[model samples]
Target: MRDFTWHVFTQTGDIEAYLLYKEMHNLGAPELGANAGAEDDEGNVADEE
Candidate 1:
């Protein structure tokens, strides 16, 4: 889906498609994996003192 969005953005120069690609890219980034267990169901990070 990200690749398709990116291809559409590149071929048509569509800002919307580019934004969608960026959003999908960010959502699937590896950085989130490191914090996956840190966040609760509501997405609030659980801090351990």
Candidate 2:
């Protein structure tokens, strides 16, 4: 699923759709293997403790 979305993004260069796809994919598991206060896909940092 990740690979397919990435492939479509690379092939069409549609950043918006790619981002949306990523957001949707991540919705189910927001912190699969990420750390606390981790930066989001857009690189925005969360508040640190």
Candidate 3:
């Protein structure tokens, strides 16, 4: 989705597409951040059983 939005933004210079790409990038940033750690759905580390 981000790639598509970015492609559209580049091709047409649509401000909305650029904004959408920026918004999606910002929204996904935290999930990949440091505090996320190596945890699972139950908040358990991957190697701890």
Worst 10 residues of 3 by lDDT: 29-38
Candidate 2 regions exceeding 4 Å error are 28-49
- The sequence of per-residue lDDT tens digits that candidate 3 reaches over residues 1-49 is 6777788999999999999989999888332433443454456645567
Error of 2 at 31 (Å): 15
| Lowest-sum lDDT 10-residue window in model 2 | 29-38
Off by over 4 Å in 3: 29-49
Q: Write the per-residue lDDT of candidate 2 for residues 1-49, one digit (tens) a residue.
A: 4555667799999997699668867775342332433355335533341
Compute the lDDT of residue 49 as modeled in candidate 2. 19
Error of 2 at 3 (Å): 0.8
lDDT of 3: 0.73
User: Model 2, residue 18: what's the lDDT?
Assistant: 90
Q: Rate the local accuracy (lDDT) of all candidates.
A: 0.70, 0.62, 0.73
Best by lDDT: 3
- Which pairs of residues clash in candidate 3, taking residues 3 or more apart in a chain or in different chains? none
Count the clashes in each prediction.
0, 0, 0
For residue 32, give model 1's deviation from the true position in Å: 19
> Candidate 1 or 3, higher TM-score?
3
- Looking at model 2, residue 32 earns an lDDT score of 37
